[model samples]
Target chain A: MASHFDVAAYALGTLDARGTEAFEGHLASCANCQVELFELQELPGLLDTVAETWPDAPVRGAVIYGLPTKRRRFQHLGAATAAAVLVFLSGAVTAIGFLGWDGADPPAASEPPTALTRLDPVAEEPGGVRGSLESSTSHAWVETTPEGSRIALDLGGITGSTPCSAVVVSRAGETTEIALFDPPKKGERVVVSGTTPYPVAQIDRVEVRRVSSGKIITTLKAPEK
Target chain B: MTERAEWTESRQSAMLPRVGRHTRAVRPVAVVPDDPKDEWVRQLYRQFANQLSAHVLGLTKYDRQWTEDVVQETFIRAWKHADKLDQRPEMLRGWLFVVARRIVIDTHRGRQVRPIEIRGTDIAEDRVGVSDKADSTVDAIVVHDALRRISADQREAIIETYLKGHTVDEAAVLLGIPPGTVKSRTYHAMRALRRALRARG
Candidate 1:
């Protein structure tokens, strides 16, 4: 005989298979247990609420299987030829502006993408070199528009989740603040898009600096026009 | 190559049952991280990550990496919009769930990675209940407070069995008690919790 206490166990999904079978048999005749089950139906969802705040590791990497692997395309090319091909590809990528964008004219700032230039860590600062800076990575690029330039930045490895601004500097030493954003976590990548009124060719460099301390974190130098 | 393509298509069709069929192109947005909010990401992780992961795990059909990716992206978006968020636990939970749902749908449509087709009535389900989701946090807080008011033994019984998803027998072993005692404690605990929640209401 399944006791009345079986209601809670059944409701909570904690019953063993035999226990569950017995309980269901008992529940068939027990109108009280039937009513109680309906009343306690919200228990599991409520329980999930409490479980949400439990401090456990959330992200786990998946083991993938059975997916088709890519076939190597350039296996026949020698190392020197491969190197030359890579150089040509990069140069072609730059000339084409952004991969997958083809048109008779360069795209408007409101349209698609452009080549992203690497933003190297600023090697020197006033007080000393940023010793812990080598671990971070960043990239920036700009597109020219009738109004000015549209700057897009990809950033990673920023510590302290600090508020920072992307500043566009001109060859004439004038500076324009293009974007203001904050890094969400240490060593996680973030993308920011902002606009500046300066033309792309006239731009000299872009700098990402901390808003609070005004410390320069990284810089991207534009190609010479 | 042809066999692989056919296999991928079959797998995609199998996976699409719960995703709901609504095909629309969603452009990926630039995500800016947080600024000046001290330990906000850490706090978000502690309070929401476990639940978010579980919720997303179901949506992704237990694909752990995709679950992690969705959760990570949701948190980053949350951090980016920290200043704009309500910051209340219930509201934040709702926001995170909604954002995570959108990410899953976007991923299903092959926006961020290779496309996989998922079809179902799920999007409507996800959309309709989002705002109502905040009430869940409220209910959780109420139930959690009620759990504290119950006897320690009763609370542990519920935790081991209900919260941890253990069978009564398994929880008995973990709690170092007989299964009968575990059931008895859970019975009493549920009664006490119902009373406590009623009192609160």
Candidate 2:
């Protein structure tokens, strides 16, 4: 079925696959949308100028597949807690010094031990972890935490319920199973979290291995520090 | 002589371009210890880093560090799939934009799940919202601004369903609103933005 035409959606470059294909189909014959997409193109460029007001910072050699270096971890907080936490954090996190953002030197305000509330943690592991979802069949993120090593695997690599083992491999070549998960529903992008007893820093890589044949489906390696 | 002409023709063949440029045995020039692929990625990063930073900075609402990360990740993807990519600069730029955009949307959606992101979103919406208005005359750009001015509920509806690129059912699930509400907000958003823009004119 053809998706409904939403010009604003198209203009913002924010359309899901179905909507995009449908819009392009409509655009093939609709001169109007063509004209508008061209005009709207300038909007992103204009918005680009907003970065000028932002302080200059250097982005060096970046490892894209590395685990996200910065984010507010409100996930799995439950809706109510997430909301409450969001309310608390936004007001509390008034002026965290971002690297290259500024050097105001307000250490007391920025790093009060009380503010260490799991709101945002620096990616402190010498070699940070990164995730990839570019593959249509899989989604994953490898992360380090104070307690242990964690890997969030969105099992989309295959259809049907399959038993899979989440294992962490150390640089010294030790393998340990972290968790056994119940089979996720077929063809759904379900994220199942697994943790190793090993601290994330010590782990060399995390892999999702099929239990039946012991085939390694995918792996997330810790980047060199 | 006829034999001389044939000899000359054969001699010219030797000067013609060779198919196996690397087939000759020469002293191995010192190869860089690094993979040539790494060099390709570095070149791409140096060429488009500033532009990608600017574009993604707007999308990420000027979270400069996050924008830089997304930009870096985009290049990394380009590097990993270097064989699959067209070598043309425009194609690489488009590919980077597409990948970076998905990261932005994912980041945006992930942020929406948290209350903190919801708070700053209004501020972001208004800043970029007006910035878009100040810059262009596209009717859709006007609507982009007008969506921000509408009731937050209605705007959220449109944003989830439309701007943030969610389908009706998906947006419904994400927003905890009904699919019908998603459709209605989209309708109301379109009408309001059109009306608002017309009123301005």
> Model 1, retained fraction of real contacts?
0.29
> What is the overall TM-score of model 1 with all chains considered together?
0.31
Give the clash count for model 2.
Answer: 7
TM-score, model 2 to reference: 0.29
Q: Using TM-score as the measure, which candidate wins?
A: 1
Q: Candidates' TM-scores?
A: 0.31, 0.29
Error of 1 at B101 (Å): 24
- Name the lDDT of candidate 1: 0.54
User: In candidate 2, which residue pairs clash?
Assistant: A64-B73, A66-A129, A66-A130, A67-A129, A67-A130, A137-A156, A137-A157
Residue A147 lDDT, candidate 1, scale 0-100: 64
Off by over 4 Å in 1: A55-225, B1-134
Error of 2 at A169 (Å): 76
Task: Put down candidate 1 lDDT per residue, B1-201, tens digits, no spaces.
Answer: 453333233332222223544321121224322224425656777788889999888777687888887887676556545666666776677667655764665455453332242111112222212122222322444566567657889999998887777899999999888899999999999988666445431
The per-model DockQ list reads 0.12, 0.02
Worst 10 residues of 1 chain A by lDDT: A58-67
